[model samples]
Target: MISLQSGELFDTTIKDLLIPADKVAHVQLGNNLEHALLVLTKTGYTAVPVLDPHFTLHGLISSTHILDSILGLERIEFERLETMKVEEVMNTNIPRLNLNDQVMTGLNLVIDHPFVCVENDEAVFEGIFTRRAVLKQLDRRIKNK
Candidate 1:
């Protein structure tokens, strides 16, 4: 599995992970979960960032949410659930990670929370790091060492 020294891997912002700077999918505050699904489908991503009315970081709409909504486990309004905004269902209590955080620190956070939102001090959505990413990065480091 991937692993990293507590403070190794990242010497700068989480922006480094955005390295090749891929086009990350995002949903506006007024946008609904349906939009999130469209973005995920187009990008083939598991999650997308959620922005508030003023474009501030709100939370994230993940595939899990979609699955839950589909399974009828989520409190979606059935017929008009897709029309509901992300704030109505996205996990707003999510923990966020900073750019300067250590790889191990980030890993630990993900260990506790399957998905961690990587962001800046102002809470701008930078990226979403999953437990798999941490493990992959750690494995790369171990092989190199």
Candidate 2:
């Protein structure tokens, strides 16, 4: 956990708790479902951020999304994974947070999501603010109080 002064707890920002982009596992928009699945499995994450060639936050891709896309009436179409692109199946209507967003703002958003993508003013991918991180901070604040 990132150490914080008791007084600073309520003033915490998303950037303070962010898992920086470089440290996060992600896939590019042009990436195939096969590659996205590999990344999700290797990182032990159900989902990961999707970016364009310039690293702008596009949306999110998940194992569930990949599986759903490849599902067929008769059976799972595993072969389709190699043919489908991430951009074709990613969830574009996702909640996002700015780097300067308050912890309370993140707390609200995380209630419905495991993690929220963070973006800079330029809409460039910064990182993610996770529900676990919010919970940890809340726990620390309670202990201090």
Which candidate achieves the best lDDT against the true structure?
A: 2
Residue-wise C-alpha lDDT for candidate 1, range 72-99, written one tens digit per residue:
5555555545666666778777787876
Local accuracy of candidate 2 as per-residue lDDT tens digits, 24-107: 999999999999999999899999999998889999999999999999999999999999999999999999999999987988
The C-alpha RMSD of each candidate to the native structure, in angstroms, is 4.5, 2.1
TM-score of each: 0.68, 0.91
Clashing residue pairs in candidate 2 (N, C-alpha, C atoms within 3 angstroms):
none
Poorest stretch of ten by lDDT in candidate 1: 13-22
Prediction 1 TM-score vs. true: 0.68
